[model samples]
Target: MIKFFRKIRQNLLSEGKTAKYFKYAMGEIILVVIGILIALQINNWNEEKKYQKQLHIKVHSILGDIREDALQIKALLKDLEKQHSAADHIIPIMESEQKAIVDSLKFILDFNSFTTTPILSQQNNTWDYLSANGILSELEDQELVNLLMNYYNYFDELTINFNNSANPVRLELRELKYELFTNTEHRKFFPTKKPSVPSKAVYESIFNDIRILPLCRYIGSTAAYFEGRFKDVDQKAEKIIYYLETNYQPI
Candidate 1:
């Protein structure tokens, strides 16, 4: 191409068409500049397409992870609700009441179920990775970002509360239960196999333990708090899922 243009220039110079040569030279320069701009434009377009495809993959992966997160949060909510109910059932039975063997076994079972553990929070592994990589900014929706931030922030707070506020109370109650009722006694009612009928003595021990009432209240309140947290997360997750479903196409 350069040789062809040089040949044209030489021919114009030989003919002494100086004005025509200048015009032809200017036109060639313009054509080269325009060709360069078109090439640049095509390059930019291809880069945009590549970035868009990458963004789509990340978004779809996040959606899948968030979907599992929704399921986990829902399951946690149900479990917390159940624990709260068990605490409710155990709260009313005090040392003053003379309960039957059936009632005693039920109370012991409920008590064990309620105070034995703390509620674990939902996981956000995909969001964590994306945030670390500065990829969350690629998300177009500000509301979705805000909701995700709020959800994880609340989850961190909930985890701290569970570990600090609830687990200590649970441990305290567990210690008291073991102090009053031996592991053999716990196994009698809460056997890995079919539970044996608990004696009235076991019921009396649980009822008479002064720590039991306060422990029940603690368990119920903590479970209620987690339930509320999960409910808020549920709303956030539902909104996010709705937005992604409407606006995002998974790869």
Candidate 2:
């Protein structure tokens, strides 16, 4: 193609048609520019297609994360509901100083399932992409961003509060070690390998021992609060699923 154009220019110049040669040269430059522009436009189109494909994959991965998160939240919700019920039963009995309440304490103690590591792991990085990269602006539903924002705020607060206040049950447990272990009657609860060795002050304190009803109630209330939060999360998750289905393509 270059040789054809160069030959035409040489023929025009050899015939002393200087003005005509200049005109032809300008026309050739225009054609070259048009070709370059067309090539650039095609390149851009191909790049956009690739980007859209990658974006679809990213959205699908995030959708999977959200689905798994919903399942985890469901499990936590079920556990919380059960804990709330058990606490309700035990709270009343605790007031009456029933020995059965002692066994019920184990229910609360055994309630731990997913550690903090897994809870944080469930939070998808898509939220960060939306916030940091303005990706959420591209989402068809702005409400999806709002839903995720609300979830982030709620979970942040809940995790902070829980981390700060979670150990009261463990703290109240020290009293059991000090006071109850000394009681010869309670010795059956302790293993013989680690004999009960309460000090005389511990023994003397039992007569004046105060119940930890407040602590137990507080723990139960905290569990119930977390349960309510998870219920809200579950609802938001449904909305997220709807958003994904409506706006995002699986491919």
Model 1 whole-model lDDT (C-alpha atoms):
0.76
> Which residue pairs in candidate 1 collide?
none
Question: Which model scores highest in TM-score?
Answer: 1
- For residues 160-215, write the lDDT of model 2, one tens digit per residue: 66556654453554455445544563453243444434344433343234654555
Q: Write the per-residue lDDT of candidate 1 for residues 208-244, one digit (tens) a residue.
A: 7677777778788888887887788788778878878
Q: State in Å the error of residue 138, model 2.
A: 6.0
| Model 2 whole-model lDDT (C-alpha atoms) | 0.62
Question: Model 2 off-target regions past 4 Å?
Answer: 97-121, 129-143, 166-211
The C-alpha lDDT values of all candidates are 0.76, 0.62
TM-score of each: 0.85, 0.70
